[model samples]
Target: MVKKFFIFFTFIFVSSLLVSKDITLKAEKEKEYTYKDKFMWLWEKIHDPKSGYLSVEGIPYHSVEKLIIEAHDYGHHSTSEAMSFLIWLEALYAYFTNDWKPFEKSWEVMEKYFIPDKKTEQPNMKYYNFDKPATYVPEYDDPYKYPAGVIYAEPVGKDPLSDVTARYGYEMYLMHWLIDVDDWYGFSKYAG
Candidate 1:
């Protein structure tokens, strides 16, 4: 009787060990998705191929439409973040697949939207002077202090990058912060 009991206990322990090993193997299999595939998932969720990521005039709404048409509000931080992620995703895709078209396309889209073109957007940039650049405005800790206190009377140093920026047709390869999309508040509320 004692010998039979010992044999039965050993068989049960071995069976459980095999079952646990199988379960672990299955779990690992489920996580076998490549890093590139994982990155693609983010693009699938937020991007529209035709319109390109819930945008307005090529500027992503941070991502809300003017009339709450979509689900976001205008913010440079949000759009910049999304734009950056898109470029990185495309870069990873190119690395994994060795197809660089998508990566180039991502950069093109980012430049077209965020970095305003010189001739079209900056008409008066030619008049810019390094010595008399826009008045200096110090960063304020208080929220209400801003869009005021522009410190016009105070003298400011000459622009260090004026020479370099002039080579690019006086156009800055930078993305300025946006307050709204489609001029929703201005033309709709102020005009007409």
Candidate 2:
């Protein structure tokens, strides 16, 4: 009788475990399915094909580090932090959607103009060499001289490190699971 009771309890426990596992997996799949639909909408709304960067209202504010879209022609310059968010967002979007084209395009633009020309410069500082040229220009007929800084004249100013540091931290923290551990940078000592 005791043996039968033990077998019955074991069977019940195993069955409950299987059922709960199925439910959990189904919930996750449902969540992803919903997000996939919304991702397409977000892509259409935020993507700026002309500049290869997300914009406030279909307008490119390349001059400033940041820009705020206003109701009228009134707005403020966006911070470098905004661009950093966009980079991380783009990577996250690609990871979820399995689409690398947009991420690749955006990264190319950022790498050219924003990824710092020297170690002394801010990580995400916007300054490309005027003499040379970037590989991708959304639309430009001139020699493509925007603005940049050397070791001293960094555009983002005294506190230029925050945005870049945040970006690197996120990339290093998450990309290991999404991509490859080898593809990501090591944990930043300066993140503190």
Candidate 3:
């Protein structure tokens, strides 16, 4: 009677462990599917060409039109606020496709929106507070200055080759480096 009870308890413990492992694996698989679904959904909404340029919902690409529409829909009409999502989308696309075209396009739009004036002074600055701790505090305010400038050729037609090099040169470089790091490791985000 004692031996039988011991065996039964051991079996139950092993089975419970197996069940827990199975549940964890299933949850991870579901999470992957969810991530892919989100990527696809956003991609489709931004790249649909026709409605894409107009910034309509359910398009598959990014455009000023979509950005404006999204801002108004969300009750914030600021262009910078709208482009924040656009920047993230551009980064995501570059990370996934290992292509720089999306980043270039994003840069073009950003230049048009932020730096439409060609005669702006060099090293023009823009500030973004990321709401994080300051690891290093500067002695002077100038040390904290973040320069914002546009380096793209003036848009003439459909050709973006020249503007690509001028506008997004630094961004393209940083993105290439970041993509390599992300591919090597990984990242996480909370529920959106």
Model 2, span 14-90: residue lDDT tens: 99999999999999888876765786666665674544443333222323322335422222222344445556767
* Per-model CA lDDT versus the true structure: 0.64, 0.47, 0.47
Rank list by lDDT: 1, 2, 3
After the best TM-score superposition of candidate 2, give how far the Cα of residue 18 lies from its true spot, in angstroms.
40
Deviating ranges (above 4 Å) for candidate 2: 1-33, 48-78, 119-192
Off by over 4 Å in 3: 1-34, 50-78, 118-192
**TM-scores for candidates 1 onward, in order:** 0.57, 0.32, 0.34
lDDT string for model 3 (107-143, tens) is 7655544333424422232221223212332343574
Model 3 residue 49 CA deviation (Å) reads 3.2
Q: How many clashing residue pairs, candidate 3?
A: 13
User: Using alpha carbons, what is the TM-score of model 3?
Assistant: 0.34
The stretch of ten residues in a row with the least summed lDDT in candidate 2 is 174-183
Write candidate 1's Cα lDDT for 45-162 as tens digits.
5556553454433334454333333334433223566667667877887887788987787687677666667777776777878888779788878888766567798899898778
Evaluate residue 161 in candidate 2 and report its C-alpha lDDT on the 0 to 100 scale: 40
